[model samples]
Target: MNKIHYLMNREVNYTLSKCFLTRLTGWEEVPLVKTDACGLVLFRFNNDFTGLRFKLVLNDIEILTAAHIHLGMRGENGQVVAFLFGPVTRGISVNRGVVTGIIVESDLTGPLQGMSLLELARKMEIGNSYVNAHTENHPNGEIRGQIKRF
Candidate 1:
């Protein structure tokens, strides 16, 4: 019983230590546009590696439309794997706020369809993923950042 408890505690600590962070800015976007918008994303994997909890904070953004995690390298575009924010009405905007959610296997789509959360976490570990924030002014992506483990 003591051995089992120790193993469980170790797993919990390991999960808590698996964190990724990214800073979003327009300059990171392809065909970069000038904008005052910026944001940050934090991703943490669950104990069982079956879910990803994320928090995205945006500032000075306008007419916000959506945010997503994409499977791609820096300076490249990729298909969306998970939606972080609204595909809401185009007129909606945010000056400053936070959007938090958990992404599971079912949330995986596009090229990530049927993939496990562990697969996505592995992608992030290797710098093959990015977070993109979309706005009315830049539907493609107003701000972008490469996800990195930290």
Candidate 2:
């Protein structure tokens, strides 16, 4: 919908590196196979909440196993929106979101000199799940989860 801005607590970086991220898709039930495949994306808001910031967690990750962005509400079968590598997280703003971004601990990148966690977390709404992987054909992801703040 609209866009908002907020800062991260510095803990988000740590949380991502330790968890698996998955996006839910389809209006009906479907199963993903490789939960631990590869090609995890590190997501965040733009420094000014205007755009999205994204990077590959693993530099060696050259393939996309299987990924889909959850669009509908939770528990609902989300559409299978295939994604390669870009600045968007399941169509959600990465650096400039109205809500939050998801990440994997092993794939979580630190808040470097150019990243702003606050502006990114402001408009977070983890309504749907974002499923991801590192291989091209690997249906099941090596890890997946919806980012959360505690």
Candidate 1 C-alpha lDDT tens digits along 1-150: 999998885665565447999999999998797999899999988777788899999999988899999999999999999999978886466789999999999989999899878778778888999999998889999999999987
For lDDT, the strongest prediction is 1
Runs in model 2 lying further than 4 Å from the true structure: 1-40, 58-68, 72-76, 80-124, 134-136, 139-143
| RMSD to truth, every model | 4.3, 12.4
Cα lDDT tens digits for candidate 2, 1-150:
122222253444334332223332221233444232233444554333333444434322334333433334433444433243443223221222222333322222322224333322431244344444324433333334343322
Q: Once model 1 is optimally superposed onto the true structure by TM-score, how far is the C-alpha of residue 32 displaced, in angstroms?
A: 0.8
Pairs that clash in candidate 1: none
Return the TM-score for each candidate structure.
0.87, 0.36
Stretches off by above 4 angstroms in model 1 are: 1-17
Model number with the top TM-score: 1
